[model samples]
Target: MRRSTRLSLALVLTAAAALAFGCGQQGRLTSPNDHASALSARPAFDPSSVRVVAAMASQDRATPALLALSGVVGTGTSIDAAGDPVIVVYTERARVANLPEAIDGVPTTVVVSGTVVPYARPGGGPLQMGTSTGNDLECAAGTLGCVVVKGGVDYFLSNNHVFARENAASLGERIDAPGRYDAHPICNQTPQCANLSQFQAVSFSSNNTVDCAIARPISGLNYSAAEAGGYTPASTTVAAAVGLAVKKTGRTSGLTHGTIEAINVTIRVQYTDGIATFVNQIQTPGNFIRSGDSGSLMVTETGNNPVGLCFAGGSGASFANPIGPVLQALGVAIK
Candidate 1:
């Protein structure tokens, strides 16, 4: 079969499998009855717990002090030695102003840190597992991973670097399937490349919470919870925990599985342009992810409940922004 034909068949088979397993019938991951349940299942470190303070800090009122005092990163919840909920406050310096007795009544701790940057580039791999980005840049294509709905519109999810070009792209940019690099030579020249338009982005300067963005596909385009290599995600999200068994489908590695190594991580990531710091993130062991897989979503094996949004990694370790804050910011729900 032709590459295009094979890809189409793959999407159809995926949708069929999703229907068969009730993982995402009709390409929808959450139903009205289950949306709340899925959101609630995303673990104890809830984003709602830190929303107010996060908003305040975003406005730049004592930014460092507020962020540290609130113990609010992307989402507020951290972990303790007993693996219980704690508040993690990150600062460039040891002392911050008005360090709180606790955040939302959770015990608070402070850590010195630097900027968290986005991971943009990675090496090559064969096509399999899940969807990929357009042919624009070799390192640009990541995984489409899953579907989401916002304002009653369907959107495909991936990393900002994958879709938005790491804060350098404009709204309504074009994204192609198999990415430009992974697509055929004639894919872009002819209209053979199945493409989507960049619809929305949570820009780095805007939220800096999750390295996330969404695209609007053409009306007849196909979506599925069935990833490449016949993997299906649960129709919900599981709260992330240390040692949780997790999996992801991406462009480079296909379907790779690993365990959650740590939670509530604060670290600096190096992007091409400069440095960006991320706080309250999740970490996975091994080089579970490579270049071209930056946008893959991390989910628990049980019911495939989403846990994190994979973005940057190095030294046999990868990081993801918790999913709760990501979806909340985008006004979208997993499909």
Candidate 2:
């Protein structure tokens, strides 16, 4: 699906911090342990923060400081005594330069670690999180990626746009691994490709915020929770947060890592036929993600912790639906 222009509003707040991990008066949440507590506190930022961030990105302005920060992936509410949204900057360097106290009304928060590079998976060698995946037909390939459990079965996790044609696909459709695009290159000679049938469609839902679908796997095909490039699955899910380090393996982008740019973002996406508006979505920088990267499972780069389901991206930005809603809608769990 082609992405439409993102719609968002700017929201400014106060407070700031920069470091590997620590705490301060301005508000600093550097540990996963603090997520639950911070969430409970409800970071204080206007809902329009998404728009604010988008506008800043387009105008090349740095009012929130996040825009000016090169390594900063995005901004989100921070855990201050009073929960308020802080501009979060993500970087791979140990030491950052020219740290600011605050931008506009929002403060700055910095996270150090992880290079963001996007690549594609085009050939067939092994079945891993970065392997190609797609319909049995001519649709573009994506990542077959991720392992989830539903009804005691090992179902492959991916985006509905990938497996279900974005709500247009039917249940029980044939699913291919190494996707049709990769499985067969002589597509022009014939309408079909050498698709390796690996899984059968189970269910999909675009009803909620997620664009996810699952399929029951068949025997004889190799599969694993491990992602490409040696990142093993943590077999758990993590909440999306600013400054959180995350990774994903996709048909186009093998194993790439980046940080959460924005959460609870509402945006519009263009499918082949029409448009769909997604709300409460997770947005990230356009680092390694690209076409054929959709349906890749977004996970923590360090522990392989599941975070979100990547679906749409364009214009230096990518978006994913929260994993919680995707699992809830499908009644599944990370395997």
Which model scores highest in TM-score? Answer: 2
RMSD versus native structure for model 2: 19.6
Model 2 stretches astray by more than 4 angstroms: 1-126, 188-208
**Candidate 1, which segments miss by more than 4 Å at Cα?**
1-129, 135-139, 185-207
Q: What does candidate 1's lDDT look like per residue over 1-335, in tens digits?
A: 01222222122222112221221111222222222232233343332445423532332333334544432322123334453444444444445566665654555555443221111121222222256664243223567757777777867778777777676777666666666445322223211122344434443343265778787765665445566646665657777899999888777876788999899887677776667777778999756777777778888876678898888898778888899888876888887
In model 1, how many backbone clashes occur?
Answer: 24
Candidate 1 overall lDDT versus native: 0.57
Could you tell me how far off, in angstroms, the CA of residue 116 lies in candidate 1 after the best superposition? 42
Q: Which candidate is the best by lDDT?
A: 2
TM-score of each: 0.56, 0.57
In terms of lDDT, the poorest run of 10 residues in model 1 is 116-125
